[model samples]
Target: MPVVFRFFSVFPLWLLHVMGAAMGWVVFAVSPVYRKRLVENARRAGYRFGEVRAAVGHAGRMVAELPRLWLGAPLPSRMTGEACVEQAYAAGRGIVFLTPHQGCFELSAQVAARRWSAARGPITVLYRPARQAWLASVMETARNRPGMLAVPTTLSGVRQMIKALRRGEAVGLLPDQVPPDGQGVWSPFFGRDAYTMTLAVRLAQQTGAAVVLARCERLPWGRGFVTHFEPLPVPLDERLESAVLQINQAMEHLIRQCPQQYLWGYARYKQPRAEAAAGVTE
Candidate 1:
């Protein structure tokens, strides 16, 4: 599998994206579960199929582009709203970068880590480890490059992020990623109750880190990505529930900017596991 990825990594990104789009459509047509979830999730967000259909191909591109991003040569990227990050860093407080499941999310942290972490401090990114041993090993090596540190979605991982933030370093997380029951709270996402991680809000509140909404938009035909970083629309409240809702609202705004590239097929509304659910309060 690594050899195959390496082989594909050498291909032109545009070609990879084109091939990925075809693969995406094939899956959408053949898998009822995927299709249903994609459509339902989009609909819940008040988007018609016509508006989000492009997301199917974008999701595939997300997968296909990983090899080039992880193991292949570096690709060119530009940033907008970069001043937001600079200002935050200059303040001497840590930064909390909250990116939704939109566009080239993987690229966002890499870009920031390279651009800022060296002068500022390292960015600890939250990610769930792959179940397969081979994949997990590959990911650990790939993610722990220069200024970036990838931590698993475990108790210790959360502690690591908090420690980073307290030390005036950055931390990145997908606030929209459903956390294991006790780790998240039921919050309104797209007018539906989705399990939302409170870590982003908690980190900021505890350490006074500047909260920013960021994403990397995949330009057409794989030209490259344009990363955007902006401040949260509203300040996070002291209350946990209010803070989580604010985080969700910020995520909703970001996703709206690039509905086409958002991962609409995620099981956003799935019920929490019974064991874990018992620990999470409604």
Candidate 2:
């Protein structure tokens, strides 16, 4: 699998996207379960098939671009609304970067870290290891790059994030991700009760970190990406549960901006997993 990814990494970005779009459609056609969930999730969000049909190809592009993102040359990236990040940094408190499963999310962290990690500190991101051992190994190798640190979704990892924040460093997480039992609370997302991670809120509240919402949008025809950074619509509430809901609402707003790039196929409504003895199942 790594070899295959490396081979694809050398392919032109446009060709990769084309291949990815085809891959997306093939999976959509062959896998009934994936197609069903994709359709249902889109419908639940009040989006019609016509409105979100492009998402199928977008998902494929996400996978196709990973090789280039992980092992190949860095794609050209530009940031807009960067002043928000600057302001956060100026606060001299940590930054809680909240990104949903939208656009080239992988690029979001890389962009921020490349630009700010040296001046501030490393950006520690919450990562859920793959179940497959081979994939897990590959993920670990790929994500542990300069200026970035990937921590597992465990209590220890949570502690590490908090520590980073208290030191005025940055930590990033996907608030839209469903956390394990005891790690998240059921909150309204897109008008449905989806289990949402409270870690982002907790980190901000505990350390007084500036909460920022950012997305790296994949440009057309593999041109590159436009990473946008901005502050949350409203400051996180002191109340933890309320803060979680606020982040969820912010996530909805972000996804709405580019529904076609959102991961409509993700099983976002699945029941939360029971916490293991280690208290971290991801």
Candidate 3:
């Protein structure tokens, strides 16, 4: 698998995207469950099938582009609304970047780390390890770069993120990803009850970090990605439930911007697994 990843890492971005789109269609055509879930999720979010149909191909492109993103030289990327980030940094508080499962989320973190880590500090990101050992190993190697620290979804990992934020550094996470049973709260996502992670809200409230919403839009023909950073639409409520709902609403706003790139096939409404005792610190 590693060898295959390295081999694909050398492919041109455009070609990879083409292959990925085809792969995405193939999966959609073959998997009845996946097709149903994808369409259902998008429709529930008030998007017509036509509006989000491109997401099928984008999903495949996401997988295909990982090798290049993880191993190849940095791709061409630019930032928009960077002033929001600058302002956050100017405040001298830490930063908590809340990105949804839209666009090239992996690339968004890479861009943040490259653009800000030297001046402020590394961006610590929370990640769940892959079940496959080989993939997990590759993921760790790819994510632990110079300006980014990838921490697992474990107690100690949470502590690491807190420490970094307390130092006025940045940390990133996907607020849309479902957390373990005990770690998340039931919140309305896209007009449906979905389990939402509260970590983002807790981190910001706990550390007084600036909560920023970020998204990376994949440019056409593999021209690379453009990452946009913006401040939250409204102040986070002090209460956890309200804050979690606010985070979900904020993610919906970001996803609406480029519904085509959002991962609609993800099982966002599924029940979460039981929390692992060893994974929680406090």
Tell me the TM-score of each prediction against the true structure.
0.95, 0.96, 0.98
**Candidate 1 vs candidate 3, lDDT winner:** 3
- Give candidate 1 regions above 4 Å deviation: 274-282
Q: Tens digits of per-residue lDDT for model 1 on 1-282?
A: 778877988988999899889888989999999999999999999999999899999988888888888878877799999998888888888999999989889889999998998788889998888988877887887788889999987667878888898888999998888777676789999999998877787789888999989989999987999999999987889999999999989999999998999999988888755333212111
Q: Pick the lDDT winner.
A: 3
| Model 3: residue 41 alpha-carbon error in angstroms | 0.5
* Local distance difference test scores for all models: 0.87, 0.89, 0.93
Clash pairs for candidate 2: none
By lDDT, is 1 or 2 better?
A: 2
The runs of at least 3 residues in candidate 3 whose Cα sits more than 4 Å from the true structure, single-residue gaps closed, are 277-282
lDDT of 3 by residue, 147-256 (tens): 99999999889999989988999999999998988888899999999998888888898888999999999998999999999999888999999999999999999999
Clashing pairs in 1: none
> Which tens-of-lDDT digit does each residue in 1-282 have in candidate 2?
878878888888889999999999999999999999999999999999899999999999999999999888888899999998899889788999989999999999999999999999999998999999878888888888999999998778888888898889999998888787777888999899998887778788878889999988999898999998889988888887898999999998899999999999999999988875223222
CA displacement after TM-score superposition, residue 125 of candidate 3 (Å): 0.6
Lowest summed lDDT window (length 10), candidate 3: 273-282
Pitting candidate 1 against candidate 3, the one with the higher TM-score is 3
